[model samples]
Target chain A: MPDFDFHVSAFAWVPETSRGWVKCLRPRWAFEEAGFAYRTTRLGPGEGGSDGYRAWQPFGMVPAYDDGRVRLFESGAILLRIGALSDRLRGWDDAEEATIASWVFAALNTFETHTSRLTDGLPGAVEAVSRRLEALEAALGDREWLVERFSVADIAMATVLREIGETAVLRRHAGVSAYLARCLARPAFDRALQAQFADFDDSRVA
Target chain B: MPDFDFHVSAFAWVPETSRGWVKCLRPRWAFEEAGFAYRTTRLGPGEGGSDGYRAWQPFGMVPAYDDGRVRLFESGAILLRIGALSDRLRGWDDAEEATIASWVFAALNTFETHTSRLTDGLPGAVEAVSRRLEALEAALGDREWLVERFSVADIAMATVLREIGETAVLRRHAGVSAYLARCLARPAFDRALQAQFADFDDSRVA
Candidate 1:
């Protein structure tokens, strides 16, 4: 119900590739699913010059959000703000919410660090992702999801995992592969993926 | 007020050289200042081993905090939770608060990265810190503090800067040096420094 606008740096979405794709695409999916009205703008690369996408982010990054009142830059911060605005994302109690917050930080700061290295063509990308995947597998041991039922933590991690979904590291983990399927089963996530990626495929062929 | 207890694993207050001295020391300081009862535990290097700290944090990092209700890691998240509980740290308004949040991320992710490299005895530490110092100096030009008034962002950055306070990089910027002094002027910060480093001076003789 709260008015929101997001400005993202434009990229040809590869369904799994691109620098800011996961950050730019996922929250939009979550917001629309929560039945919130929001507008999105994609700024071309270097369109804003030195300011770049920082017009939307003081820190000069993409995936910035403005809710008419507060403008937030960090992707994790923006996701937290959106979760606070919607009942669909947060957990039932403060403890659950705090736990989810821990996982969110872990997903980005810990897990995603390995993921970033993997994507950046670093030497140890495969080994690093393998270690993280093993950890995620152990954490998910015999469980369907990270916490009880589905929550924002799942969304956050899934977005990152989706980046390396095609890699052998994730495919080898039966639980993680199954979890990815469950995340995509959500009609909201499916729709967002299709809409966001459709233009990229079209551009590539042209 | 939230009927919570904080269990903090920290180094025994030395004086100035405690790792995570600022973060681990501040909440306790705030709690004591607020008349809240809490428990403190000390963990020494090589005493707990790898699994010890990593159990609380996958990164094997320090200054992890656990409330009876919910366990939270990451200083930024801990600070946000503490700020929400009390208004002592939030800035003048929502925008200012948002600015404070960006600075918190910037300090840790951007400024601290360069500062850490500078302190880590790397080959290019000096050049890296010098470049970052110039950038920060320009950003802080003519401003007394990061924002109009002091907030937690200042606390976070001041603590990070303490790691390299004695470096020539900081010495080169008169404004940054003055800014750090202003942060240290707070009685709370002074007590934190004392609690953190009092033992280090004696250890030198040992």
Candidate 2:
């Protein structure tokens, strides 16, 4: 396999609690799922906010990538770039690709926003998330994946949904929960999860 | 110029205060900036939650687009698609395009989130917004735009920043404030803003 000159970034010290759930895993899972050989650099603990870090990631966020040319941040954008290279993840055509990319934004700006609020037990959070999930559930309606086949859109949306897991709000929607389960059941997600865990503590193997 | 047969959605009735500030303006401004001919559909007041609305927009958000090909929501995605078709908004090349795309996400998922809270008078909202603004300020230091030349990144970032206006947090960051001024000064933004106001009640021409 040709090593894709994709060098990404992650937090050096993600506490065990949030290690498996950081946003960096999005790119990792995308690369793993697309069978793209990529590597990552671990910034020092809490170094994500440093000036050096901010150069690549203006908001001082994680999971920026350099494909031996463009060094860009935002997992959504990175995943889209990766998706552009791999046909399966890239979707069938320009319109399909944009639709797929839209879901990634939906995950970040909608589903995840509500899910995070739900987790924090914020007011009216469940209702907000459920509304979005209801739409997603109806869209899924026994579909095996989001589009024709599993694409980068699922990688983005599932990662956000995965955070809800067997939680209260998630448990209320059987179809959505099942969809989440199916997404998590992917070997790519497992490998990505393992990789994240491995990055946390050297003793663990991905 | 030929009409592009692109149909977008927006609030049928935006109150005087937010008439021109609706999210739909992102795509409207984008289309105008790219000089693309398009039209829009107005969903009745609070009709964003309808099943028909949710079909194209899972979260039932405004600014969904159907361009005879792909139907999608998320202004970031829509802007990227529009940017892809326009050289001025698409940035210089592949790397530049992805970087511009990343900024769009930053605007939606990061900057906008902060500004929303700041508007709500949420605790520590100013500080939160300031941090991101600081990073943004650094990036735009001694520069006219986010990327080498003006691109879609500026459009996205400027729109979000425009929400804050010459307000508290923004007032403290002169450079960032000035950068936003440069973006909104564009004739396209002026036209889009005017078009949005035209969609509102006679009481507000904002």
Candidate 3:
């Protein structure tokens, strides 16, 4: 895979609590789903702030992406780029693409905002997340995916939901809990998880 | 105008504090930028929860969009769709499109999450937003827009930044402040603001 043209940047090491949860997994999962061979450019400790890296990722965040075609950062945006390149993950048409993009924002911005706060145990966060989950459950309504088909929206959503998977607040929304299970059960997710952990191990410094 | 193909939904009325800051203004501004004729589907009091409205916008938020081509929610997503539809607001090519999308997420998700908290005076929120604004100021560097040109990404970023327009935290980032000024100075933004306030005035309930 040395010749792999697509590249997604990731952290070589993260704290034990964050090892499996780094956002690089979003693009890594998308690559797996798209069956697109890609490599990870691992940034170790103290390496994220290099002027060059900041040029690629202004916030110096993980999961900056580049292919010969384009270079960009933000896991949600990286997922969209991969979606554009892969038919299986993209909307079947313009209208469907709009729906997919909507869910992407919903997952990353609308839902993640509350869920991340809940993860941090911020005061009043539970109520915010519960309200969102109720809306999500209704929106899901027996659907296995956030849209008509499994797309990058689910990838963004599943990753965000994973932040709260252990919480009693999440357990209360049976429908949403089931949806998260269906998303996480995908083979691509497993591969993405394994690859991220392996990177953490292989890139560990002495 | 009665037969305009594009429709952007807006709240018919809002409290005085929220009159000009509604999310619907995002799409309204985009429509103005594209010079596309569009009508507002005004949602009156308690109208957001109607089953049909919920179907269009799962979270019952304002600014759900419907054109003959596609119908969707999420202001960020709606802006992307408008960018796709209007040449002036889209990228020159695929690579540029990816950059625009990245900044859109950067604004809506990354920056908004922190800035919104800072606006609410959440404890420790200022520090979080300050760090992001510094990075953003560095990123803006001499650029007038987040991407190569004025696009929906700027729309998203500008609106989020407006949340903290009055804060000393924002005033400290001179580069970012200038960049935001350039975005707000656009004639489309003024039109969007006028339309939103006028709607609030006309739609007031007895």
Candidate 4:
């Protein structure tokens, strides 16, 4: 019942492997980097399926955000909103901001879109994911980050790459693997991952 | 070269079926809605694979944008930059802008991601698309556009829906079908569609 400036929705618990892998970590990482204090509203059993939750999150997905004035869903959108509100995370200029947006889309639409389907164990999915990873590895080249500096784009991309971290397809790209290591090395990322892991119940380990 | 205020990348030619379906339509539609006159840099064969094009567009995809000041790739990102620049297409307020961003991600990450995979004809893919489409239909109840007014969110969603327009999966949702029709009925969409089709050669009819 406290008047928290920012509130992000998450699940009450997730399986063991999914402990720190929830999409909610995106917002949590952003908030940590921004040095912002925010509260989390964890959904109970069947809450995500309720009509009220649907009104907030059209797809019953977690990581929806409310910033006192507006409600926003989609981790990519929420990340952008967080960047806009946080001085530390925002780009230096409008053009830099556009670059950030471009990388965000690349991470979600271009990369995650393919990586998410790999679990299906389809040949086509493997090929598709491989093609995109090659492009991403090429895109990364020698740049330390997706944009000028560490931003939400890296947060998005790193999380996506982490989801498929153990795959040989991703392991082949040494530069990408190194890049992921650098991103995960950030203290903020550790804070965010631990926060999400803390929310899960040890009794329910899937 | 003429000093055009804005420029967008596109393919010099695509197959007949893919003519209007090219993602360049997204930016063209946005420009039309904004009443902005922009030039198109049509990529000839092998150009998308070139190092220069890759520098501008990491994935070497079409619909990259340049406004003399900054360059950006990804249709969703380009749409957002257009919204920021155009008075007509942008949200009325900052909060409304956040809403537009949310829907844009929903269209690209949520909907297009699944629809794109359907061409592979995987069962899991079909079920995923159906679930998301049902949510979309339910969320879209009694609404003409994704946001308050017709914005880039509509452009992204409309284009994504149109890609799967002929599929029974999409057609099953009456509300979503009507929404797609409403979006296509726009003069800007028509203009953008024809503009893309005009760029393709008649000989390539795939």
On DockQ, the candidate that comes out on top is 3
- Supply fnat for every model shown: 0.35, 0.69, 0.88, 0.73
Which candidate gets the maximum TM-score versus the true structure?
A: 3
Task: Summarize candidate 2's per-residue lDDT along B1-206 as a digit string, tens digits.
Answer: 24346778877676568778888898899888877878878777557877777778876778898777677788888888778878667777777877898888888887876786677666677998999998889988899998888887888898889888868789889999889888989999999988887776543233
Runs in model 1 lying further than 4 Å from the true structure: A2-22, A50-56, A118-136, A162-186, A198-206, B1-4, B11-38, B44-60, B109-142, B159-187, B196-206
Q: lDDT tens digits, residues B1-206, model 3?
A: 23448988898888889988999989999999988888889888888988889999998888899987789899988898889889789899988898888999999888988887888788788998998999999988888888888999999999999889989999998998888888899999999999898877453688
Model 1 lDDT tens row, A1-206: 63454433334433353533645666666675666666665544444334435445544445667777787665666666667677777678887777666666567655675675566555667887887676677667676767776766777788878878888778988888899888868887776665566535445433
**Which residue pairs collide, candidate 4?**
none
Better of 1 and 4 by lDDT: 4
Model 2 chain A: lowest-lDDT 10 consecutive positions: A197-206
In model 1, the Cα lDDT at residue B37 comes to 57
Better candidate by DockQ, 1 or 2: 2
Model 4 over residues B126-159: C-alpha lDDT tens digits?
Answer: 7888899899888888989887888999999999
Error of 1 at A103 (Å): 1.9
Candidate 4 residues A67-152, lDDT tens each? Answer: 89889999999998888888788899878888899999988998888888886565677888888888888988889988778999
Ranking by lDDT: 3, 4, 2, 1
Q: DockQ of every model listed?
A: 0.33, 0.65, 0.84, 0.71
Better of 1 and 3 by lDDT: 3
List the global CA lDDT of all models: 0.65, 0.81, 0.88, 0.87
**Model 4's TM-score against the true structure:** 0.94
TM-score for candidate 2: 0.92
Candidate 1 accuracy as lDDT: 0.65
What TM-score goes with each of the models?
0.73, 0.92, 0.96, 0.94
Better of 2 and 3 by lDDT: 3
Per-residue lDDT over A44-130 for candidate 3, one digit per residue giving the tens place of the 0 to 100 score: 877789898999999888889999778988988888888888878988888778888888899988998888788778888999999
**Winner by TM-score between candidate 3 and candidate 1:** 3
